[model samples]
Target chain A: MAETRQWRLASRPTGEPTRENFDLVTVDRPEPGPGEVLVKTLYQSVDPYMRGRMRDEESYAEPWDVGDPMQAGIVGEVVQSEADDFDEGDVVTGNLLWAEHAVADADELRPVNPELGPVSTALGVLGMPGITGYFGMLDVADPSPGETVVVSAAAGAVGSVAGQIARLSGARVVGTAGSEEKIDWLTDELGFDAAINYKETDDLEAAVAEACPDGVDAYFDNVGGPITDAVWPLLNVDARVAVCGQISLYNETEVPTGPRKLSKLIESRARVEGFLVGDYQSRWGEALESLSEFIQQDDLHYRENVVDGFENAPDAFLGLFEGENIGKQLVKVAERGE
Target chain B: MAETRQWRLASRPTGEPTRENFDLVTVDRPEPGPGEVLVKTLYQSVDPYMRGRMRDEESYAEPWDVGDPMQAGIVGEVVQSEADDFDEGDVVTGNLLWAEHAVADADELRPVNPELGPVSTALGVLGMPGITGYFGMLDVADPSPGETVVVSAAAGAVGSVAGQIARLSGARVVGTAGSEEKIDWLTDELGFDAAINYKETDDLEAAVAEACPDGVDAYFDNVGGPITDAVWPLLNVDARVAVCGQISLYNETEVPTGPRKLSKLIESRARVEGFLVGDYQSRWGEALESLSEFIQQDDLHYRENVVDGFENAPDAFLGLFEGENIGKQLVKVAERGE
Candidate 1:
């Protein structure tokens, strides 16, 4: 490859991120060194968490430096390799550049099989979001049989898988989302017992209360803020909440305030915990196995909102906050043999 | 017994409770019925949680009826018995009335020994607060050696013991209190690494950060609201917070609002759990055994702010919110053998 088109961080965002904060640039594609593979990007994952990386301040993940090409969970095919770990035709997925072609260490590239599922799925249900939903629901939330589990941002990548996993645990699943389409996708297609269109609902607490008559036993919180506040009063005794993501607060310039629910937690003897998929790195194979099984058995349904072309990648990332995607949001950078 | 002096619920208070909410009355001593025993009150425990009972609303515990005498965890003597289980003169502690004399089901009373420590301790260290600290600190928070543990309301009955327990686990204990005397007791007597008089501290978060330089690993929270708001930002990765009580908000007429820290939990991957001592009913014996050993070995010290007369029971209970009591607040209805 002569040139690699990439989206680089132009500046740190103040409030909600904009296109001006990113710059599209073309750089000469470097040759693969020893123990490295050159890959042509097939699909690129865009997630809400990437917003945190755009800030200059320190957070859980390191800030993406200004003028650096942004990195994402990109699935690509190896076009050139100098390592025994990969062949020229091998399909791989890893944390790589948001570009048409990039060089990565062979060890960083995880091989993906096109025989098992669609190649693009390695960026969504078969990858980070899937494993995140897997561990967070089963290990963190730990919902039991017949218990009511409520999930926020239900049609999103992590939340969608989390709700499905809760159902597999014999628990009643209720989901909250922004659109009727997402709500339908959750309840009608994904097997959630109830789905509340939070954007349309005037009284969120009442909607949640009606959906979870028995009170929420477990909560998979993907979008925090008001959604979590609504879930507070309805928590059953010993309720467990897994804080997966807080996309609602991610774009906010000022810290938001609300009715503090520590007292309510005490009254209910409930628990709220936060987690990141990266923390469960050691046990990912276990999660991937279960997620793959669920997908192969048709027990887990997957969806994606893919934006076409490398030029539209930044918009694909920004669309997360606007509730523009139904499931995992991704960008298609190139053809299979580009 | 000729007369039993008692405090009955006169009216429910809207905000902070007042003495006018209670009515002191003299009644004829009650006699034991079948399967019951007549108890003459000795040490009467007054806790912040009792404030919730005074409200005529649906909560975790049943609301105290307006016409009935306010009940509490009372240590008393069995004066007369119709039940074979409790011998006359046996020192017992149970959920009993504010009156000096009342009938209790034999099953309600738990036996306490004067030989192990002062029978008054059954109202403080060897009782509910002790078990609350035991389970909240050890079981829920689960602080490890070399970790920093912060306990709010750290001079109170539960918080003091919880901080001590964390210290016993080899964690550096940071305590927050309201009085200089209580601060002295926590740091000098109880071996707390640092104590902040939250009332005098201009910047609570800064003070907490200074006290817990390594960041908070475990937090035993008895006082919630702003004190908790300060601790949220200082949480280390995988921190455990035991929400034992929200004494600060117990009297709030409206739900108090503050910076929502749910997003911070996600960033730190921390866990906050609430618990009542009653939830560990099956494990009371284990807690008691550990508590007694801590006291017997002189590893633990206890303090009680004793109100000398039955007339002051309501005052003692009200003093909790004002930070009047240094340790366990109790009303001494009569002499031990009265």
Candidate 2:
């Protein structure tokens, strides 16, 4: 038996998360049962959406109980295996724990192809966030050629992929970020037509309008709040808005109040639909295949903000709320087994 | 030439409309030229949607320019025709002015088949409101059999038809209306599974939840504001909302704010789509043919809140904001040609 150091929910967060919300503990790692593989975490994803799961309520993801280890998107090496599909030293990815070692059923793990790109990319642009952007943009917000597509949280894992995909679809892509670095990355690197640093803009609506001169035709909304309020009025006739996430309101202890917009929707004949990437479980292959092609062709770009050491997982997770990460925020637990 | 008594926009209204916003003008009736017909106005629809047009901004319906006669769905009779399609004394329906008489291009008019039902139905169940209800219910908020469907403004022209159509689809129909009279009409006359007088109810959310034990599968929203805010949480997984009208907010002077809801939509994977009846112009024949069949079979019921005389057209239009009308609000301008 080996030792596993893991992060657990010490308390449910109030308002915004603090370091006191989590506890890092070491435990005796157990042996794998039949049809299971012992995965040693190399990289684990930290996302803003995990904030919602901390609450004691039913949501898209199940709530986390106090004192229980939190689960997240993890890319790991198979240190030991009792399953036929995975060999020792094979790199795999699945929804796993923020621990150094996790016992997962072989069926739940997907083999990460190092031949495609870095194995860590599986936890970022080639995983749930990427799939979310793909399905939400293509299925829900179906932007047309020459139309303006606006994405919020544009430097984050999902929005970066969404904006690039919209640009690839022959639409002009506009994005809102929090820093000048993110703005530069979105416009200079990712080929975004316009990138607005919301923290720097005084009148967000005016900034969005100036960026989208013809008004927004499609909107990929990830951080809903005042940002969404600003985008509502600028929607052109027959616009499409895909509600992918509402990270801004995830930690609010009380209900948020803002402008009512059904009247705006009616006049524009627009559509606002909420979607989850899990809904396309049958089409994961299709999404990954296309996403892999984009990466190979150098059309899609990705960045990973890594925090070394497994014990620092909670800090990495908490950093998401402060907009500390430029792209996918991940905590590295160990080196990959060769 | 006959002197035509008509109402024109005196000024763009600020806040709620008043008498000062309109002017009653008497002008010499103009003659129809090539490809036109002279129609003697019989009935003119006065709806809540007209309030949006009274503003000076572009909307689904173009803004009514100050000092110009406003147009609506009018059931009229052709007195004289210069076009080959129309004959004298033929009852027709088209978008026409609020006047004693107006000339219209023949291609813009659809001859009302009075042999099927009363001529007044051309302004209610056989007109734009009916088609709006039809496509909105069937195409957007597609409720399955045994599913629960809730409609706001249930006693209004569009909502009334929407409920009946949902009932015809074999779904459980619930409605929210203003008065006890309207509630009874929805439950007893229109065959809604449950009806709530939103004005009378203290806890609307509880009432709606009790009525829909399985949660709402589809929502046909006509009145937006607190009424819609109540139905947001009761939505089931994959719920669909057809944003047909927002009569409740049409009179709002400033930006209206309430609890934000994009988070709830994301959790439920629900869809809210705003649609205009004009978008389905190509499918009008299909809608009318099915709607006419419903009328002939007595499966659908409709009511007209008729304000006698063309002189009271402004009063009828304003009454909609006061929630005075039960169903289609129309001013009877004249008798059909003998």
Who wins the lDDT comparison?
A: 2
Question: Can you write out model 2's per-residue Cα lDDT over B1-338, one digit (the tens) per residue?
Answer: 57788899999887888878889999999799999999999999987888988988887788998999999889999998999999999999999998989999999999997787878888898898888899999999998999999999999999999999999999999999999999999999999999999988999999999888999999999998988999999988899999998888888889988999899889899999999898999999999999988988889999999999988899998888888999899899998754
Worst 10 residues of 2 chain A by lDDT: A329-338
Model 2: per-residue lDDT, tens digit, A185-301?
A: 999999999999999989999999999999999999999998999999999999999999988888889999899988888888898999989999999999999999998899999
Clash count of each predicted structure? 0, 0
Per-residue alpha-carbon lDDT of model 1 for A176-222, expressed as tens digits? 99998998899889999999999898899999999999999999999
Which residue pairs come into collision in candidate 2?
Answer: none
**Candidate 2, TM-score vs. the true structure?**
0.98
User: Each candidate: fraction of true contacts kept?
Assistant: 0.93, 0.88
DockQ of each: 0.86, 0.84
